[model samples]
Target: MFIFVGCAGGGTSSMFCQRIAKAINATDPNLTATFGGVNEVLADPIACIGDHDLMFAYGSIDVVRGYSAFDFGQLFDAILVAPQVKYLTVTKQKIMANYPTIVEDIPSEIFGKMNGEVAFEELRGELIMLDLLRGYQSSLQTASKNADKDIEILVLNADHRNQQLAKVFANWQRYGIRVLTETYTLEGLYQFDPPADFELRLLFGATMQLNQQDFVRISRRIDGLIVFSETPKTAFRDWRQQLDDADIPTAILDARMLEKRADVTQLSAKLTDFIQTVEFQAEATAGQIRLPKLQTKKAKKQHTLFGIISWNSTIK
Candidate 1:
């Protein structure tokens, strides 16, 4: 079987490609895995994923839409950080049914830091599970050609590798909230995926230089938007205003939030509440503007949450 993985820059996807390729080659050398960037695959799908058995694309919904135009046997958005139980169980059953030989025993010490043979075996299991889950989801949605996402959130962060931000995104996924940022890292890839009727895509503004048309396209689709900036006062005010003018739900967060899990958790909760509610009136508090608390969902949602978190950077 051929596995093709594509991400915005191809860095994260390439690493996963290499790991899965190494594991698969140990047992079945005939199987192959490859990686490419968003532009490369869109420029030439046949050259990047020719004769592919399955394809996984991780990025914004636009990236997924561009890829869905092709005729891959199975295409997965690869956005679910933590999926529901039934879907995960079905994924495992399919893998066991098809590739029982690749399965290995789990070590008793699977909870914490592991090393030596235990680490090796555990990593192997993880690769197999991820590989199978991608393919299984693709097969389930083979009939549909459209990218059916219930909610799409755009995140702008200075560092894509921020551990606190990573945990926040994972928690949001655990609660069935999908996200989008500018770019992704290996650590991010390890903790992400999307479910049917739900999706997550990352587009970090600090890394990816988005043009006017790019912003226009993205602005129309996103349900909620949050930005984490080191210098929010100077860097994000104008752009934030532009989004606010367009009536897009936008929030400007202090980059220091990336330093603590609790802060990020509070930010995530605010975003989640914003996504579910229908209206919001911005309020400022404690040198940090809270986005919006939960209003009622009975009426249509108006993208009006304009929040900003600014304070002395030295506090961090």
Candidate 2:
């Protein structure tokens, strides 16, 4: 079986596709998986839909909410017309649930005016109609394309951000990127050794309050820091000073900047430059580098709930 997974962005969704491919490949030697950004897939819907046995649509809740019934009809119809597709799976709710930071951060007023159940049913109805129309259109598009194939359409209503995060971490591990925390001790660090040819070394940390002493210790090993924009400018200033004192570089990223597709592309370019500069500086000061040996401890992992959706239909 050949599967094509399309996501809204390259960061989280790309990571999720990698994990799905890994898990599927491990269990089924006969199956293969590939992934791309959703816009890329939509640009040539005919080829994308016709070539894959299964097409997985991964999007945030905002994607669904932003689309009107008519717009969704066209999208749903396009996918349904693909003769080779046996399954059409949507994992939006799962995506929202996986990202607690996104959920909890949402204002209550946003939910106050809407009825959740009613909205969901309306969306589901639109999707079902699209499926029916696709079945009707299939015969006109391709005479030999699996007219008897069973097609399944499923929409899962559960959290998904955590699953995406798991994929992100897994990818980081595969690429040798170490994940560390703001904890003062060294043992609290989670490290990934990048490939020997990898040029940049980075450390990602998040905290409500950054300790200067801890920052000093972490800067010893990492060439730079990943700081979120949500952090106060005052805290960022202190962290910057500490990093500068230790001769380490810093990149301040806004988590919200990812909401817009265009911003995501721009951010990717900026990050690439930031990483290259830090790596160059680190290489120049290689002889003077001295890593600290702070105490180590096992990091505790958090657990969360996830949901799955599946559907089936006989091709006419």
Candidate 3:
């Protein structure tokens, strides 16, 4: 077994997994499978090809103990981390990720608007995520010829910065990743009218506060796999019973509830293929780096992490 994790344009990755499942199933009938491994891994893609199991999860397995979805290198034959711009790194550990998404998400809108009053203790900056991705992509583009491996780009942004975002896209082209043309959307946000309230006026920007809950509530809608057996006493057993009977590993990824955001998928496949396969040289990808925005803080958390930056994924 092999495990690869990262921020992939859901479209291509989804199709890729489906196609892989098809090809794999053709080789053997008993191999169970499932698709859609997000920041975390999962059980299976198809219903009945093999046992349901997850090959990845949140956090470094070696650094932090106690996890059901880990120890892939020990249990499986190979390990892969197809991370987006940035992911935490624990050296000497077999586990890895495509990118590092801080399991944390606080609204930037609050810090920007705060009516200039909300005191935010220097948590982190927008560039922290973006810069890592840019450097990661730049490093990878410098290494591989496949272009598929080098397209790993990542970023974070203010809701109103789409104008500046145009400039961001332009910069990526300079790096060879060309995210605007390569990336695909993971999640698309729904528009909702903000509720009228006075507290929002003081705590956060009216535009953000009004719509925050709407975004958070939408989190329950995830693409998890389960089934019913239509049984007697309990009404029915889950269809995954076969997988359970086989004792296959499983991991659930709840991506529905993150910061309110949207997806962008209107990109060319030629670009997507190029971006996914890029990588960096051992010497360059070996050390640590910092984001410009963190310059003010003399004491900043500097830990080696994995990252990728592709423009086409989150633009919507």
Say which prediction, candidate 2 or candidate 3, comes out ahead on lDDT.
Answer: 2
Model 1 ranges with Cα > 4 A deviation: 1-148, 176-200, 260-264, 277-316
**Among these predicted structures, which one has the highest lDDT?**
1
Candidate 3 local lDDT, 19-125, one digit each (tens): 44444344434333344443333222122212432222222222221121222312221222223312433321212232222222224342223231121122123
Please, what are the lDDT tens digits per residue for candidate 1 over residues 74-120?
A: 22222221111123333333322212112122223431222333433
Model 1 lDDT, full chain set:
0.41
Q: Report the poorest 10 consecutive residues by lDDT, candidate 2.
A: 150-159
Off by over 4 Å in 3: 5-7, 39-316
lDDT of each: 0.41, 0.35, 0.26
Ranking by TM-score: 1, 2, 3
Clashes of each: 16, 14, 50
Better of 1 and 2 by TM-score: 1
TM-score of each: 0.34, 0.31, 0.20
Best-to-worst order by lDDT is: 1, 2, 3
